[model samples]
Target: MKKTAQIFAGIRTPFYYYDMEILENTARQVKELAEKYRIDVHYATKANEDARIVSLLSEVGFGVDCVSGDEVKLALGCGVPVSKIMFAGVGKSDEEIFEAGIAGIGAINVESVQELYIVNAIAAKYGFVANVCVRVNPNIDAHTFRYVTSGLNTNKFGVSESEFPELVEMLAQCNNVKFRGLHFHIASQIKDIAKVTKTLCGVANRAVEWFAGHGFETEIINLGGGLGVNYENPYGDTFPDFEGWFKAIDENIVRKPGMTIHVEPGRALVAQCGDLITKVLFVKETEVKSFVVVDAGMNNLVRPAFYGAFHLIENLSAEERPSLPSNRVYDVVGPVCESSDTFGKGRQLPLTVRGDLMVVHSAGAYGQAMSMRYTLRPIAQVVYSDRINEAEKETPIL
Candidate 1:
């Protein structure tokens, strides 16, 4: 961080700084663990679709898990093989289905029985057989945020257990759609391993057996990724518990012969490697509260305003002033118009002043991907740690 801080000193603020070393280390760890457990790991493209990140993960032997036609095309353009791409979503348009069919990529995870017929019709029109996997609602609470929980019966993400018979009958009729296996995605930011090993795996195992009994052979079991990262302490234990996660699956999941286990991890692979670097614009002191306003707004990073998520905030410039007391508390806010544009309230830090650099840690997952031009704020630019010297030469110091 000290070395990277020097680079940030010269560059403009309100940009995303990616630590390549951290990303590479995390990716290598995930790959090693996945290979050890004989699991097919797919990089969830929705996490951070930066071409460089996607290309790096693809080079590291991770497949791409896409939730849209554009993502599918993006994966293919990034040198990911067609056989390694998986398309999944609840509401896919006819045009998107046609794109996937024409691409002839890997399995399309069918969320509804109706989608199965649509995929079949699209494949038939395109003169190709579409491989599909039934996305089942395991009815297991992921113990995460309500907005991200998908495996519950109340969630509109996957087909419920009661709909399995109809789904099977529909699958039997869709000649252009070949049943590949079952897919289950519980939620995002799931910290409990028991939820996966004790609850999710059991539900999936029984579902696989039930399908087999109905004369439908299961070939792939895609346990969708919701592995959480340490948000409170980004620097400490920067990597997720990939070893424990794979071990749990290895010990608990019951896979049939010739079956493959797949995981679609998004945040776990890229979250820790990124930080939203912004400049402190003003230091406002009211009778009731103190606010450290920044140049970046909710348009730059919305996790705090949107999901009420937490990210470790650090005042980078204050590190150089050792004499300054590090005991002040203030609310860190952005320049956006909305009251919810606040990043962190009651944040403890050193005496932060105007022109100081501040960073929101662990923002690689949905940070840039979910950014918008709301209020016409310009999107943040990206800077890589490996190319800092070049950036220093080109970027004008503010």
Candidate 2:
């Protein structure tokens, strides 16, 4: 991990470089802190559920937070037991619900009463009772990426807090479903406490305010993952201030000791630990604009194109990294056809060449998970610790 710059200096490009040491430490940090509060934390599988990544998280005593039936199967396949997995999504198909029922997952964070009914029917058919938590749209803004924002009232995600009483009545009237708790998700990449605290505060109040009466009690409060990472400077604070982050929950949320406060943290735990590596395919110097076309494309990392995201670009070949007024300014583009397929535009970095290798810093989460085969691009591969990637880094052109 420490030699990321030096190691990528000689290796092939267009692949993601994962820092195992950093990732291991991240898992330890999360597990240890979560243990302190005795809170149940499930790492969101949607972040980056590589087999090794999931296994490392499991070793640290984290549960699984999956958004789809496929992710649930991946978690279980990777040895994260169904007993410790939770499924939450707005559009789970009947087939997925039936599969979850048969698997008897730990809990299904149901987005609506209709979903709860479907899950219940599937459970009844499977001769099992499904545990479920209703996802409530807290209507709080996370102030992060608009594309990732999922908890607004306008976002077709969760049930309204106003409908909680009716939902409780319906749940009590049902026989096959076991009510678990209330689930709340504000938005993603939230850095402001005002947003998180307010969302959590709303969740806390609604738990006791909306459903606790009339024999309906809320158990788990699954705050869906959306913790914004330090894209501005990932290494500045390798890990987020857990104390401050948790303090937001502490000062804002009023959780009873008995209630299992669950957090679904995805990027905050892994973003700093990984970097995407790509070799410079060509350095075109046009009078209009300089372009650095890399071997890796939007197919390998789509956050830039899909969400207008930015990943710090690093010139691995530069012995002495950039110190502005950096003479270099290039549009670090990929091989994808669409103009939006670029990663960082007009970014300042050390001068690079066609053979020079580059690094896309802070791509641990939502990086490889979002890769696609668009434009017939072959998927990118990843290499573990720098030491392990040396010999095998010479990947053939795809």
TM-score of candidate 2 against the unseen true structure:
0.93
Which has the greatest TM-score?
Answer: 1
**For residues 158-200, could you state the per-residue lDDT of candidate 1 as single tens digits?**
8999999999888878889889999999999989865465688
Q: Which ten residues in a row have the lowest lDDT in candidate 1?
A: 389-398
Q: Which residue pairs does candidate 2 place in steric collision? A: 14-278
Candidate 2 positional error at 50, Å:
0.6
**Highest lDDT, which number?**
1
Error of 1 at 374 (Å): 0.2
Model 2 Cα lDDT, one tens digit per residue, 38-110:
6688889898978888888887888988899999899888888787899999999988887876788888888
**Local error of candidate 2 at residue 231 (angstroms):** 0.8
